[model samples]
Structure formats: structure tokens, C-alpha cells
Target: MNHAVEPIELARDCEAIAIPGGETVTLPKGTAAFLTQSLGGS
Candidate 1:
């Protein structure tokens, strides 16, 4: 017997998750600043 690792595209195709309505969610200034710092300004 053999097994193969699935590609990311395949995995994403098989999975589903819910997203909120708005394109962007408003967060408090403090929270936004913290996230920006954590993500290195993305």
C-alpha cells in the first residue's frame, strides 16, 4: 500500500470555512497597531 500527500490546492478545494460579510473588519486602534507590529507591517 502507498499514500501520497495532497497538494494545497486540492486541500483547499475540499475544505470550507465561513467569512464575514464586510471586505474589511474594523478593529480598535490598539489591536490594529499590535497586529501590524506582529506581522511586520505585512
Candidate 2:
């Protein structure tokens, strides 16, 4: 469950899939991502 707001900053370019279309995309460095939950080996 999400309790605290997790703030993450990308250290380098990372390839990720676009959720809606499932398209492969690259997340540039310094990008921000918030994690509410983590599962598996993420």
C-alpha cells in the first residue's frame, strides 16, 4: 500500500513501455517517477 510519496529521479536513460499503447520508449536522464508500489524484482 502507498503510504509516503516516493520521489525518484532517473540517473540515466532507461527504456520503458508506454502503458496505454504499450510502445517502447526511452526515459531520458533526470526524469521523475513516483512509485506507489513495488512488486517482483523491480
Candidate 3:
């Protein structure tokens, strides 16, 4: 699989799952993130 390397910033708080535990968590606003992957239909 090929992963993206784009950089991005959150404009608002986002909800995402935590790895390892798969727990639901809120990602606070202004969080910096990297574009990791885009699956078949995602």
C-alpha cells in the first residue's frame, strides 16, 4: 500500500478512534495531521 505524505491542520474538533484500544476520542481543534492512506473507497 502507498501512503500520502501531505500535511494538514484541523479547522475544528474532530472525532477519531484511538489505536491499539480502538477507543473513541475527540481530536481537539488545530491538530496537525499527516495524510497516511486512502483505501479502495475511503
**Of models 1 and 2, which has the larger TM-score?**
2
Best by TM-score: 3
Error of 2 at 3 (Å): 9.1
lDDT against the true structure, per candidate, is 0.28, 0.79, 0.77
lDDT of 3 at 31: 92
- Segments of candidate 3 deviating more than 4 angstroms: 38-42
lDDT of 1 by residue, 1-42 (tens): 233343222212122222444354443332312111123342
- Name the regions of candidate 1 deviating beyond 4 angstroms: 1-23, 32-42
Q: Residues 1-39, candidate 3, lDDT per residue (tens digit)?
A: 465577689899988887779999998888987655546
Candidate achieving the largest lDDT? 2
Reference-based lDDT, residue 8, model 1: 23
Mind giving the per-residue lDDT tens digits that candidate 2 earns over 1-42?
Answer: 564476699899988888679999999999987655556773
Clashing pairs in 1: none
